[model samples]
Target: MSVKFRPLADRVLVEPIKAETKTASGIIIPDTAKEKPQEGTVVAVGPGKKDEPTTVQVGDKVLYGKYSGSELKLDGKDYLIVKESDLLGILG
Candidate 1:
């Protein structure tokens, strides 16, 4: 996917991965009870601060703090703009 937005100064644009809607036992979870996903796919990345370069890259699956990042909508899709520091780690 091509995103028109680009983050600047060590920030990242993430497309949140939706939390599971069903349990292993086949129980359906309600929206009100679902927790925000702490994981997402990196959709866009910014140039690093003067000295440091951003590490994450687009298409990288990553883990982040549950409360990290600011939420926004693009093309009716939800996204998060977080600092590289807010990212916990890149998933293998």
Candidate 2:
């Protein structure tokens, strides 16, 4: 509970949980385009924004829009930086 994210206002820098090896469409997406993918592992989390505080935590797996967030790489791993509003919902 002591951990925190460097969120800029309502924007949350999130790292989405990784996707399955095979996509839901049953297609294997190549690596290059996958760099800016919606799938990733949640490593860090931001505190929250005004009004609508972030309901997500560091370990929650979430599904975002196709062109949802800003993609980043940490330790050669891909991550997504999305606004708290961009998050659709927490996946079960």
Candidate 3:
């Protein structure tokens, strides 16, 4: 991923994964009831603050809290900017 926007000082830019929109039975879920995704791929990461380096890196798929990070849009795609602490863990 080549994002022009780079995060600074412990901030990370993440591309959020979309939540499931259908059930196992093939039921289509309406937009109004869709849950915000809690998983995403780390697109960019900033240099860590003094004495603490960032643990995650670009292309790392991570899980986070449901209400973590600030949301923003870049080139028509949604992204989140969160501190390294906000990320729960990296996915396999």
Candidate 4:
């Protein structure tokens, strides 16, 4: 998964990972009942703000706040555009 869209300064483009469909009890959860995933793969990144540079890279998998970004679609796929500060951490 790669995208040609590039983010401006301090902004990042993320491809959100879908939430789990099954619970621990083995119940199959429907899409309408599922929560939006907080984790995502970094698809594109901005250069930096004037003084502060973004720590995340394009390929990094990151955790962000649940309601952090604005949703957009590119090539029929969903993506989020969030500020670097909205990102919580990078996944190992």
Which candidate ranks first by TM-score, i.e. highest? 1
Q: Which pairs clash (backbone N, Cα, C closer than 3 Å) in model 3?
A: none
Residues 23-74, model 2: lDDT tens digits: 7889887766464446444455666655666677766767678898777666
Which segments of model 1 are wrong by more than 4 Å? Answer: none
Candidate number with greatest lDDT: 1
For each candidate, the alpha-carbon lDDT, in order, equals: 0.95, 0.64, 0.93, 0.94
Error of 3 at 11 (Å): 0.9
Candidate 3 per-residue lDDT over residues 34-64, each given as its tens digit:
9999999999999999999898989999999
Full-model lDDT, candidate 2: 0.64
Ranking by TM-score: 1, 3, 4, 2
Better TM-score candidate (3, 4): 3
Local distance difference test, candidate 1: 0.95
Ranking by lDDT: 1, 4, 3, 2
- How far residue 50's Cα lies from its native spot in candidate 2, in Å, is 3.4
Write the residue-wise lDDT of candidate 1 on 1-92 in tens digits: 98899898999999999999999999999999999999999999999899899989899999999999999899999999999999999999
Q: Provide the clash count, candidate 4.
A: 0
- Considering lDDT, which of the candidate structures 2 and 4 is the better prediction for this target? 4
